[model samples]
Target: MSGRDLLQTQLERGIAALGTSLPGGAVARLLDYQELLHRWNSAYNLTAVRDPAEMVTRHLLDSLAIIPFVEGATLADLGTGPGLPGIPLSIAAPEREVTMVDSNGKKVRFLREAIRSLKLTHAHAVQSRVEGVEGSFDCITARAFASLADMLGWGGHLLARNGVWLAMKGRHPAEELDGVPPGFRVEGIHLLNVPGLDAERHLVVIRREG
Candidate 1:
């Protein structure tokens, strides 16, 4: 099989392992996004996982694994370096409005190019500190961006009423739970089983309380 074929097979199998279905052309777009990231990564160093196949497992599948938890029409991916879950989620669910937020100029530039090239009509990129970003979102996602306390402290105000906050962490963050700051409560912590990835993954679900 060719390299492209391998990537396709890997992505397909990983999607199947997740037991979820994506819209038609989603797989193709995802591969295209991966290719774009790979090419840009050569000069920009977007991510450390350099292999395409590994990108399928680590970047693509890992992001898709939280699809079930992601709700609401508007989503803000804070500290979204290279648009991880934001880009993939937008490709998978074209209807959701996704905003990829990052402080780094290069990453935001790459995100804009990806949005344009991928034709992600509902996705937008903003180069600003997470706390500085404006607008309320139905859902917020931060992938290992910062500690729970710090993330919620800085960007908690951006979450709309009854909005869900999904924080992706490598391990079960028991210690950080206490640091979740006031006005926010831990709803649940879900373990993510990403295909072809043998590492620990946890999604901490939080919500604003009255």
Candidate 2:
């Protein structure tokens, strides 16, 4: 089979593994986004993961694993290189407004094109540092962008009261939990089961303490 076909198959398998009940066309759009990412990575170097099949497991599935933890109507993906979790989450939850923020020019351009090409009207790309972003979001996602403390330090103000901050990490970050900001508290740390991904993946759920 051709490479794209193989990728489609892999993505379908991964989605089934996640056991997510998504709207129709969600899987197709994710495959399309990955294709666009692979094409652009040839020159722009958007992500380090090069193999298409691996991208299915590492990027797409890894991103979708956090879908269950998301809450509320708006989400902001900080340091969203190549729009990893942001684009996928936006596709899955089209009703929610997803804003992908990044400081890199090329990555932002790629994200815009993907959003337009994939017809993701609810998702928008912004070019700025996390600290410079404006407005509050009900859910904010940071995918290994920085330490839990530093990420909350830079973009913590953007989270709406009672909102949840979903931080993706490679391992259980026991040490990183030591310095969570004053307003936010560690609500939960759930382990992720990403099909075909061997490395440890955990989602750190932080919410503003009442």
Candidate 3:
């Protein structure tokens, strides 16, 4: 089956598992993103998940799982390689401004293309390290970016006073929280049941106490 066909099937499976209605526009945007990723992956080597079916589970559904927690907020996706949670989040919540940051120039290029293709007015891709980018955000998200402690060290400064950091992890990160930085405090740890993927998922929300 073609990539688009596979994506459609996977999206159906995801919709069933999520048990929530996906925005009509989201389906088209996700298909477009998969097509672009497939085209770019040949040259840019953006993501390891080349199969469209896997992209739906690993990228689309996995990102969508956090939508309920991401209401209307200015979000920054640190280390957004090929715009995993960032691009998908932008598609799901068009009103929310999303900035996708990545250190890899090629991946940023692909992200920008996807943004343009999707006509995402509220989304932009930045080619820079997390620390180099300025401006505080209401919600900051990262997927497979770094360890909890490392993310806190670099991305902690980019969050607004009452902002929240939603870090996506594969497993419970209780042990990694032992040496958290001084300014931030863990508000909650949510176990995310992502659709179409069997991997363990956790959303760690942190906020600055002072």
User: Among these predicted structures, which one has the highest lDDT?
Assistant: 1
Clash number for every model? 0, 0, 0
Judged by TM-score relative to the true structure, which candidate is superior, 2 or 3? 2
Arrange candidates by TM-score, descending: 1, 2, 3
Which parts of model 1 have CA positions greater than 4 angstroms off? none
Give one digit per residue, the lDDT tens place, for model 2 in 73-173. 99999999999799999999898999999999999999999999999989999999998999999999999878998999999999999999999999999
TM-score (C-alpha, index-matched) for candidate 1: 0.98
lDDT of 3 by residue, 1-210 (tens): 975776788787786777756677788888888888888998888888988778888888888888777744799999989998999888888888999999998998888889998999999999999889999899999985788889989988998887888889999988989767888889888998887677899998888765
TM-score of 2: 0.97
Model 3, 29: alpha-carbon shift in Å? 0.9
- Candidate 2 weakest ten by summed lDDT: 13-22
lDDT of candidate 3 at residue 167, scale 0 to 100: 89
TM-score of each: 0.98, 0.97, 0.93
